[model samples]
Every structure is written in structure tokens, then in C-alpha cells.
Target: MRFATYLHDGVTHAGVVGDDGLHALPDGATVLGLVRNGLPTALAQGTRALRSPAVPIERVRLLPPLDPPTVRDFVAFEEHVEGVVASVGDGAGVVPEWYEAPTFYFTNPYALVGAHDDVPVPPGSRLFDFELEVAAVIGHDGTSLTPAEARDAIFGYTILNDWSARDLQRREMKVDLGPAKGKDSATTLGPWLVTADELEPFRDGDGFLAPAMRVSVNGREIGHDLLSNMGWPFEDLVSYASRGTWVRAGDVLGSGTCGNGGCLAELWGRGRPVPALAPGDVVEMTVEGLGTIRNTVVAGVDLPPVAPARPRPRKRAR
Candidate 1:
């Protein structure tokens, strides 16, 4: 079943996507809340709602599918890693050790954005970029799980766009420290959370998810990559993350950026600065089976006006 969060008549609601329209859930409820209660509860409630004839999906604005308790983005695509390295001319390739263990970064839960919301370009950012990715939502809570067990723990999948401010990222990385200003602004995800059962047919012979992903800027296609290119599968990454750490339901695990120049840094030379995003730019990212996410860049917070300086009364006193 496809699940989503949406806004209608100025109220946010959780719902299941149906052929006719949205099947709205009860007030003060969410997809994440349903997942935490376990799939049986979710399925039972969701299926019942879906059968209702009163709900209208077309009247609502789709939000991100999962309200994650925590979000961990993993770098598991070797093609993306290699492409980034080549763009920077750092001569750095995917290390053998990277495959030995899963590597991920923690993201701010509060920065989560809905599927059709505007993405605010961070203030002072001159280099804004987009990444096309696939992320999974965890269903079961556990630790030290094996790869086989990890697969069963997956609740569903969604498309994600890991937006970046490349200039800020480079400056911050020079300090070899926190993600701070580099990635804190926003991450766009979801039009729907497609259940694991629905995606089973797409799993390849290599046991990897093989969704087709594409990214476009202002209606022009820029990048295309296959989800099957990841070096570490979702099970491997989940199991690795669960080692010495507890992974609970509603937690999101990203498949990192895809290859074939998904971002500007990879497509254009890193040394040559690119045009900054303006107030009207639109970025659209899509993954097959999972729906598309389109975000418009709007002017950020308004700045306070500069006050006129007081008359120079201090000049005589000095």
C-alpha cells in the first residue's frame, strides 16, 4: 500500500493513496505513529480507511511519507563516490574499507520537508545542488541484527533529494568536523511511502533494489542512474547501523546520492563557480515506483532594514 501525509482545508493528515482519492486517517495521527505500532495495526487501519468513499485525495497536498524519529543517510553508492572524487580531482576512490562497513551521517529531524513544499536556499549560499536517492524506513526495532534479519525489518521505501550547499560543505569539511552549516538546511523526501511488498518485484538477481532515478532542473533532465549501482544493499547498511546501536521503527536510512552527475558538483567542474539559485528556480527529482518531488526555491527569511545612524553628538564630547 502507498501511504502519505497531506494537507487539506488547512489541516495536516495522514492517509493511504487509493485509486479514487486519499483515505484520510484520524486526527493527530501520522504514518510514523502507525509504523511504531507495528505493521498489523497500520495495515488494518489503513485498509479500512482505503475502503471509505468519503475521502478526496485530490483536495490534499502530499507531504513526506514518514515522520522519522531519526534519519541516517548512508554513502553506499560507489559510482557516486567515484564521480564526486573525480569531480574534485582528489584522486580518491572508494576505499576497500568502505565496503567492509556501512558509513552514514545523522541528519536533523526538524529539517525534514514535505513532498511538494518549497526548499529554501540557505542564506549566503551560492552553490545549491541536488541529489537523487532512495531511502528506506525501518519497521522493527532491534540491534546486532544479521543481514537476513535486517531485510525483514524494512517497512517501506521513498525517493529523497539530499540538497547541498557545495561551497559551505567544502569550507566546513576543511575543519574536518561537524556537518554544521553544510547540511543542516533541508532534505526533501516523498510523495508516497511504497511498502516493501510492492517493491519485491523490482529486486534484482544481485539482491539489490533497481529503481530508475532521474533529476531535472527547470524541466531539463540532467542526471539518470539506476538504484542497483549501490555498493552496499539496504540490509547490509541496516545491519551495520544496528551494531552497538538500536534502530527503531520510523527511522529513515538513505541510499546516498546516485551516479551519472546527479549534482552540479559532479556535472560541472568544482573549481569553476556555478550560478546561485534564485527565487524562482524549480528542482524536480524522481525515482521509479516512488513518485516525484518538486520544490521551488523561494526567498528565505526577510532581513531587517538597516537603521540610520544617530547624529554625531559624541564628536564634541570626544
Candidate 2:
């Protein structure tokens, strides 16, 4: 079942997406609470148990399905890594350690937006971009879990647009740290959350889902790829994420960007210079079986310039 959280008649609600529209869950029910309670058990009880009338999908405004506790985004696509390395130059290439394990970075969970929300160009950014990816919502808490166990802990999937400020990211990452303010603005997640069972048919013999992923800008398709092409499957990503740390209910794990032009940087890396996103441009990301999320870019906040860091003399340990 496709579960959703939305606003209707000025009130927020959690419900199940169906043929008619959306069937509201009991009052006070939230997607986060439902996941904690167990998606399969709720499915067994059926939507009829809610007894709320269906509201036309068009009438309600969709919101981020779940307000995750944390967000971990992984670069699991070899092509994306290769393209970035090539574009960055300096004779860079995919690092050997990247093959040893799935690597990820934490992003701000408070920066999340919904499917139809407006994303702003981060201040001082001239190269705004969108990353088309998919994410899994954890169903329960677990630490140091095995791959198989991690797979069973997944509640559902949602489309994620890892909004980026390329120019800012480029400069900041040169300090040997990952993205900070460059990715602090907004990350889109929604349309709705489709339960794990819904994607069962797409699973391959290798235990990975094979879903078609596509991204468009203002109605023109620019990038496309398959979810199955990732260097590491969701299971391995989840398992690796849980190592020495806990992944609790509502924690989100991103599948990173898909290859074959998932973002403008990838294309730029390949020597295909595409224009960056500007205010008023619309970005739509679609993943087969999971659904689609579309967001519009808008002008960002302008603040006072930050002062540069002062240099400090090096001190040696005695």
C-alpha cells in the first residue's frame, strides 16, 4: 500500500493511497508512528479498519511522508563517482577504498521538503542542481545488523531529490570535509511512501530492485538510469549504515544519485556543459513503482557575508 501524509481542509492527516483517492487513517495517526508500529501488521488489518471516507487526491496537498530522525546519503553509483572524479580533474579517479565498502555522509534532516514544495537556490550559489535518487525508511531500530536483517527492517521507499549548490560544494569540499552549507538548504522527499511489499515484483535474483529512474527539467527529460545499476544494493547500504551505530525508526537512507547523468555535475564531468538550475525552473524525478516528486526552484535567502577563518600557527606536541 502507498501511505501518505497530507494537508486537507487546513488539517494534516496520514492515510493510504487508493484508486478512489486517499483513505484517512485514524485521527492522530502519522506515517512515522505507523512505521514504528509495523507496516505489514497494519496491512493485514486493512484500510477498511480506518473507516474514514476517501478524499480526492487532487484536493489535498502532499507533505513529506515522514520527518526522519536522520538522513544518510550514499554514493553507490560507480558511474557517478567516475564522472565526478573526471570532472574535478587533478588526475582524480575512483578511490580504491570506495570499492571496499559503501560510503555515506549525513545531511540535515530538518531541511526536508515535500513533493510539490518550492526549493530555493542557496544564497551565493550560481550552480544549483538536483540529484535524482530513491530512499528507504527504516521500520525499527537496529545496530550492527547483517545485510539480511537490514533488508527486513525497511518499511517503505520514497523519492529523494538531494538538492545541491555545486559552486559552494566545490569550494567547501576542497578543505577535505564533505558538503555542509552547500547541501543545507533543502532535500525533497515524497509523493508518497510505497511499502516494501509493493516493490516485491521488481526484485531481481541478486536481491536488488530493478526500477527505472528518470529526471526532467521543465518537462524535458535530461537524465535516466536503472536502480539496479548501483554498486551496492540497499541491503548492503543499510547494513553498512548500522555498523557501530543505530539506525532507528524513520531514519532515511538514500541510494545516492543514479548513473548516466543523475545530476548536472555528472554531465559536466563528461564534458557536456548543461546550464544550471535557476529560479522558476521545475525539476521532476520519477522512479518506477515508487512514484514521482516534482519541485520548483525559487530565489534563496540573502544574508550578510561570512567572515573568512583566521590562520593559526601550528603547534607541535611535546
List model 2 lDDT by residue over 16-56, tens digit each. 88888888887888888888888766675346634567899
Task: Predict model 2's lDDT versus the native.
Answer: 0.88
Residue-pair clashes per prediction, in order, are 1, 0
Cα error, residue 13 of model 2, in Å, equals 0.8
- Predictions in order: lDDT: 0.81, 0.88
What is the total number of backbone clashes in candidate 1?
A: 1
Off by over 4 Å in 2: 44-46, 49-51, 88-91, 311-318
Using all chains and alpha carbons, the TM-scores for the candidates as numbered come to 0.89, 0.95
Model 1 scores a C-alpha lDDT of: 0.81
- Give the lowest summed-lDDT range of ten residues in model 2: 44-53
